[model samples]
Target: MIKIALFNHKGGVGKTTLTVNIADALADLEKSVLIVDADPQCNITSFYMDESRLEELLGESGEDGSDATVWSALKPVVEGRGDVGSITPWEMRKGIHLLPGDVLMSDYEEELPTAWTECFARRQRGYSVTTALSRLVNNNAESLEVDVVLYDVGPNVGALNRVVILDCDLFITPVAADLFSLRALSTVGRSVAKWIADWQTIRSLASPADRESIFEGLPTYGGYITSAFKVHTGRSAANPHADWEKKIAPRVRDRVVSVLGAVNPDLIPNFGGNKVGGVKHFHSLAPEAQKYGFAIGKLRGYVNPGHYATVDDARSTFAALAREIVRRAGI
Candidate 1:
């Protein structure tokens, strides 16, 4: 299975939205796929659920051990159980399933780093999140013939994000083109680059006794995607505006590649830019809220509720994004 993390450390960059919509597009292709919402906000899960289940899932409920919490699943990886494959997916469709996120996932930001620092940490124990996720999805892919695993990570680049990216074979980044986001694009890219570098450096430093126990197989970063490039309202869509087609395209394309260029050739994630039509949807509070899973229906009552594609002139941009991912991943 081709595993990829749709991540950016900056919020408001359409990470979860891209995760849900693109995975849905892959479902349209009859590809068996699973989306693991690692974000604590759980926005991706809320979109699939109505308001009622959101309340229950987000609440501090019982620890009867029957219930599935994202936090509890991390335990098998944290201890020396070497068990990362037991968690089952919550089915959403014939081709698509989800491992829902809980608010407790936010705490992982602090826990993963500390766990990795411990001397007793095992290969699977040090990075429970990835090992478990990899094991679960890898097993499912082989047994059930699934095609992909996509992770929707929270807006942090600590050990959890590091582990997730490490395990992934591809990365489709969702980013906004604002000044802050552009800066974030560079910073996050550098962080990911350094993360891979850290793995090799640590591997070399490990004593013969500690090497196998501490470092699991090293992770690789595949290509990335930049989503939701804003369009100026007054710009002419009547024809290919020379400015947008020529001048704007190259700069935007370069922005993504520039950051990822200087890393381990095979290990550095490739950044291929893509667009989500977020600007047109931003005007209506209902559309904005629905995108974030704060509402049940479309921004315009006339728009079909289940039709959640990132529609631009009625074209599903997300489907194109999914196709691009499948092609680039060579799946």
Candidate 2:
């Protein structure tokens, strides 16, 4: 299965939105998709599920009967109970499943950092901690039979992302048209490079059996989705904020080329060449879709009257973006 992470080191870049809609779009095309919400904020999980259910599954008292969150599977390894347990994915739709995220996932961040260092010391627990997510996915792959696994990570270059990104086969960054995002492109490139190099350094010292489960080659930069842009032309494309696109797109390409080109030059050939799709400001449609608890692609007519145009734009843009990402990632 192809694993893709919807990531950006900067928040408010529509990473969660892209993750949800892309899963919907891919599922519409009959691809079995699994969205693993790795973000501790659990925004994707909150989007799919109601607050009451979240409280029940991951409450303050932690008294839930079901353990469906990704953290549940990892708790076994983290607490030295056992290996990673089988994951129970909640089916969001016919062909789409969610390995929901939990707020408590933040608690494991410290343990993961400790494990990262201890792994090189030949501690079995350290290696297990590093490979927990991969093991969880592999444990469920046969039953899930998923075609694609999508990851949603919070905006940080923390230990959590260090583990998740290692398991990813390709990464699709959701970027906003802003100066901050332009600067963030460089940070993301550098962070990913360091993570890969450090992991490889550790892997070089691992035993044959440990190496089998310790590392999956780092994911390559697949492409980018430009989101949250002000559409001055409003789909007319006469003069749609040319300066924002002109500034950010080329810089994004350069950052990726400079960071990853030495290893995977073919992933991004030139400026704007790796841009998969552009999503303009999806303002009202975003809340509307969230209110309905479904993807905008699945929104229907007459229910949300007078917003048919907005729904159409949301559906078409996300569908096209998903298609382009899948094609570019060669899934």
Candidate 3:
């Protein structure tokens, strides 16, 4: 399976929304998809199920001594009890599965920093701790036999996210048209470069056996997706939102593509451009899709006639984005 993470160092960039709808679109294309909710906020979990169902999953352990959440699977390793345990993902749709997120996952953040330090010494326990999430994801993906695994991570450059990013085969940044999001590209670029270099050093320190056991190498830069930008009826240069889009594109090229490419040109694909796709503001249709627990295109019987066009647009937009991702990633 090709593992792709939708991430950004800045919050409110529509990462959760893109992760959900893109998975939905991929399912429509007959690809079995597994979404790993690595974010401690559990926003993607909320999108797939209601509060009562989420409570049941997170509140108590299963008969098999698991809660079927990301934290539950990694809890054993974090506490030094054992390695990651088996997790059963929830089938959100015909071809879509969700490995629900846990609010308690924030607890794992404290363990990663120490584990990362010990990795330089080639300690088995340290490697196990650091690769806990990766092992959990890979095992579950194999069991499900899914075509792709999409990760939704929180907005930060924390130690927890460092491991998550390193575990992936590729990652995409979801950005909004604003100065804050623009500036975050620099942080994302620099942090990823450092993480990849450090991971390479750690790999060099490991014995061949340890290296073989823990060797899911560095992730490459897939591309960036422009999201939550205002849609104007007319494509005029005078429009402020259009102006921001114009400005952000070159900066994305300079900050993200060039920086990562400089580190290792192979980290970026030879695709003509780095923009995978874009999503316009969905307005009320976005909330309706979330409330109904369906992609905008999948919502039926609950949407008003007035929003039909918006739904159609959203469906087509996501479908095209999914196709581009498949082509670009060679999935």
Candidate 4:
């Protein structure tokens, strides 16, 4: 199964929105998809799951060993008990499941880095600590026949993200049309390069058999999606105005190629093809969909006819994005 992380070290770039909506679109296409909310904030989990149910799975009274979150599967490894045991993902639908997120996940930030150092010693704790998520997904994917695994991570270069990034097969970045996003391109690019190099160095010290114990190398740059490009007002539909894509698109192309090309020149992103469609601001439809747990595209007549166009726009845009991601990531 192909694993893709929808990440950006910048907030408000529609990262979780794209993860939730695009995965919904992929499920619409009959693909078995699993969304792992790696973000400690658990916004993606809240999007697809009921708050009460989520609380029961992560609350104090519910913090028993039976809790089924990404954090639950890592608790043993983080405590240096042993390898990760079977991960029981919460079923969301027929083909879509959720390995929910917990607020307590932040506790692993310090633990993972310490484990990384121990990994060079070929200790089982290090292997279990570093490979918990990968082992969970890999073990589940084969039996579940999952087509794709999508991850939603918070916007940061933290220790928890390091483990997630190192384990994935590919990463799909979501950025906005702004200077901050342009700057984050550098942050993500350099950090990923350093992580990959450091992991390789650690693996080099291990014997041949133990070398395979390291988590998968840093995920390849799958592509980028530029969100919040156009500012929508009541009259935007009547009179179209210039969007940020024109000014920011070239910079995105240049920065991605310059930073990531050093590793794989052929994988340099092409703006024309790699650019997923600019997602339209769905305004009220998004919050409404989240409230009712409906896919923005399929939000049935919960609103007036006037807002139908926006819902349709959100539906079509994410559907196109889902297809683009599948093609680019080769899922």
Candidate 5:
């Protein structure tokens, strides 16, 4: 199975929106999928549930249930016990299952120092933070019926983000067409670089060559996906570009592209390459997505052909990105 994560160190970059729609797009193609909401914001989780259900789930996301959330799912396995799958496949749609998150999930941050302590504990083999998360996903998940697992993560490099980054196989970056989000591309690249290095550092010290066998390899991030992309005619784009994307994209495709290529050329090639991967852009189908409280991709009519002809084109873009992922995973 492919475990894909949607993350950006920068906030307001449409990370959650891309995660939801991509899952829908994949489901349209009949691909079985799992979406884990690791973001304390739980925006993705609320989107998947009805009103009352959302309220209840949000209540559950508090300190009272943080342990029962995805964090608990990854706890070290007891001698004879197993991890719990908080998700019920049958209760989920035929092709999709969701592990929800919420706003009150901030306790995960408070719990990090304890985790740092555990990592240094010499408690047991694979008891490190990385292994704890690995064990959680592997143990708690009863069974996965799909080929892809998507994680909607928050914007940061703290405990959960670190663990999720280590556990994911593909990183789908969603950035606004603004400056701050674009500038964030550089931070994301650096974070990925460090993550890859650190994973190797830990793996090298292990006794067996396949010590990291329990976890997936740290693949270079999938190319960034631009959200709220307005018309590209250069006429202010009706709004030039968002503040975040403007500062970030160039650093990603320009400065870091070559270095990333040296490390994993297949993941992020030259922007205009023949490979199934390269930098690509996507805009919001409506004016609302660019401003306002909702994303156009979330609207029910979003799938209608007229509303998203670009989706057809973007699908090819992401499909290539997906192909790059499969190729790297040796699938």
Candidate 6:
């Protein structure tokens, strides 16, 4: 399976939305997809399930000691009980499944920084802790036999995101046309470059057996996607956010693509440019889709003439984006 992470250091750039919609689009293309909600916020979990069902799944362990949430799977490692355990992902639709997120997953963050430092010493436990999520994901993906795994991570450059990013095969950043999002590219770029270098150093220090405990290498930089930009009409044919989009593109190239390319040119994909695809603002349609737990393309029994064009537009945009992602990842 191809493991791809939707990540960005800047928050509110539509990472969760992109992840769900893209997974939906991929499923429409007949690919079995598994979405790992690595974010402690559990936004995607809420999006996929109702409150009662979500509470039941994430509340506590069952009589058989089974808990389907991500935290429960990693609880053993976080609490020093043992390595990561298996999780039962919730099937959302025909071809889409979700490994639901947990607020308790934030507890795992405390162990990561210490584990990272110990990695240079080749400590077995250190490697185990750092690779917990990756191992959990790989095991589940294999069991589910999915074609792709999309990880939805939080917006940060902390130890948690570091380990998650290292575990991915490739990562795509979802950016908004704004200054904060633009500046966040630099932080994302520098942090990822350092993580790759540090991981390489750890690998070099490891024995063959130690190397077998973790992913072979860090994730490649899959291109960025512009998201949540408003599409203006009426008085002017041009989008008001066009200028910001223009600014974001070159900055992503300079800050992300170039910086990581310097570390290892192989880290960058040769096919897609720095800007992979974009999703325009969903406006009122966003809440409607979210309320019904559907992708914009899959909304049912809708007859709003006003939203007809927007729905059609969303369907095509996400479909094209999903295809581009599959092609770039060589899946």
lDDT of 1: 0.58
Clashes of each: 5, 0, 0, 0, 24, 0
> How well is each residue in 72-157 modelled by candidate 5, as lDDT tens digits?
34332321134333433223455777776655445545554455344344333333434554554554344765667777888887
Cα lDDT of candidate 4 equals 0.75
Candidate lDDT (C-alpha), each: 0.58, 0.78, 0.86, 0.75, 0.56, 0.86
The stretch of ten residues in a row with the least summed lDDT in candidate 4 is: 232-241
Query: Which residue segments of model 3 deviate by more than 4 Å?
Result: 61-64, 229-238
- Give the alpha carbon lDDT tens digit for every residue of 1-331 in model 2: 8888977788888888888888898987788998888899999999999889877767522323236688777777777878876556888889998888888778667689999898778788888888887788766755799889998999999999988888888887777866677688888888887887778778888898888866665777877788883333345555545666887767766776568776555444443467888887867777767876788766766346677777777888878887877776667
Could you tell me the lDDT of residue 229 within candidate 5?
37
- How well does candidate 1 match the true structure in TM-score terms? 0.73
**What are the models' TM-scores?**
0.73, 0.91, 0.95, 0.89, 0.70, 0.94
Residue runs of model 1 more than 4 Å from their true location after superposition = 58-64, 76-85, 119-124, 127-133, 136-144, 204-226, 229-260, 268-315
Predict model 3's lDDT versus the native.
0.86
Q: Name the regions of candidate 5 deviating beyond 4 angstroms.
A: 58-68, 71-92, 103-105, 113-129, 139-142, 209-217, 229-239, 242-250, 259-331
After superposition, which runs of candidate 4 have C-alpha atoms over 4 Å from their true positions? 60-64, 229-243, 266-272
TM-score of 3: 0.95
TM-score of 2: 0.91
Model 1 per-residue lDDT tens digits across residues 115-228 = 555423344345344345455556555665678888888777776677677667766555454445555666566777777666656556666765554334334444444544
Highest TM-score against the true fold, candidate: 3
Over 10-35, each residue of candidate 6 has an lDDT whose tens digit, in order, gives: 99888988998999999999999999
* Candidate 5 C-alpha RMSD relative to the actual structure: 5.8
Model 5 whole-model lDDT (C-alpha atoms): 0.56
Q: Which candidate would rank higher by TM-score, 2 or 5?
A: 2
Error of 5 at 227 (Å): 1.4
